[model samples]
Target: MIGQFPPIILASKSPRRQELLKLMGIDFTVVLKEVDESYPSGLNPTEIAVYIAEKKAKAFDESIRNEIVITADTIVSLDGQILGKPETADHAFEMLSALSGRRHDVITGVSLLKGHKLYSFYELSEVFFKPLSAEEINYYIAACQPMDKAGAYGIQEWIGMIAVEKIIGSYSNIVGLPTHRLYRELCRITAQ
Candidate 1:
């Protein structure tokens, strides 16, 4: 399947995204370019994600040619507020505490750029967490060190194994990329 596509460049530093792309059988190279991730305040989670993803893609404008450049951003939203990567263990605990016994939306926005053409989309997944005790949260934090994950958790980590009660959409989206949607988009773009 990957043989049908053009040369690919994945513009992200995330190991999870890299692993997911590899698992999809898509051959690609990892390229990193620093881009400001901040977005306008009034935008919703989906918009914020897509905006950042497109911003990352634009950074490669000077170097792009026949290669399809892919970039993505994932954000966790609870009650309309975004919970970004936790900067500290204490912050992770706070984010996890607020997420305990609650449902949140994980939105991953993807952008594909080839030359001057750009395509962008977003996928949202609903994740529900069973009520977590302080002990459980503390243990997961100490064991997983979820400081680098959005909402202070990774759907594929120790916290997910014991805490995730249910999910209503793509599991891959919560992990930071929507594989099914991404695959479809890639097929569409590469066919053009």
Candidate 2:
């Protein structure tokens, strides 16, 4: 790990997050914990993301300490509404249709917990898509069942290869983790 504070623990079960951490060369262990991913009705997308990450961190066993525990949550925002992983193909299609040719935001929240200390932050990226035809959307949908992804799409997938026109922020944020900000934060936390 860059910081060398202690062995890191990942509080999420997301393979995307694990892959990101691995790419960053950060050694970490996994402790899958489920937390209610709810938020206050008025909270914005970034706030909701951070709150969910904190919730996941708190879900860990109380015996956890000393080691740094990293938890993260991601969501898509368009027209002031938050979009999460779809439960079905229909839901995924609906989400993609809503985002077709529109600019949306992807936000990822990270929470670092070490004993009594807790730190949380969020990063946002703006993604714009070209107007996608129904045939194109259907083709991509059939090729990649993105029901498990937010905004019913993955920026690293087939749809992204064609539909995504411009991205105004971190690419990793849309993929799920925001590794640059995460690296900096890890350095700061360990330097303390």
Q: In candidate 2, which residue ranges exceed 4 Å CA deviation?
A: 1-3
| TM-score of candidate 2 on Cα atoms, chains taken together | 0.95
Off by over 4 Å in 1: 1-3
Query: Whole-model Cα lDDT per candidate?
Result: 0.93, 0.87
TM-scores for every predicted model: 0.98, 0.95
Estimate, for each residue in 141-173, the C-alpha lDDT of model 1 and write its tens digit: 899888888899998998899999999999999
Clashing pairs for model 1 are none
Q: Write the per-residue lDDT of candidate 2 for residues 125-171, one digit (tens) a residue.
A: 99999998888888888999888788889888899999999999999
**Pairs clashing within candidate 2:** none
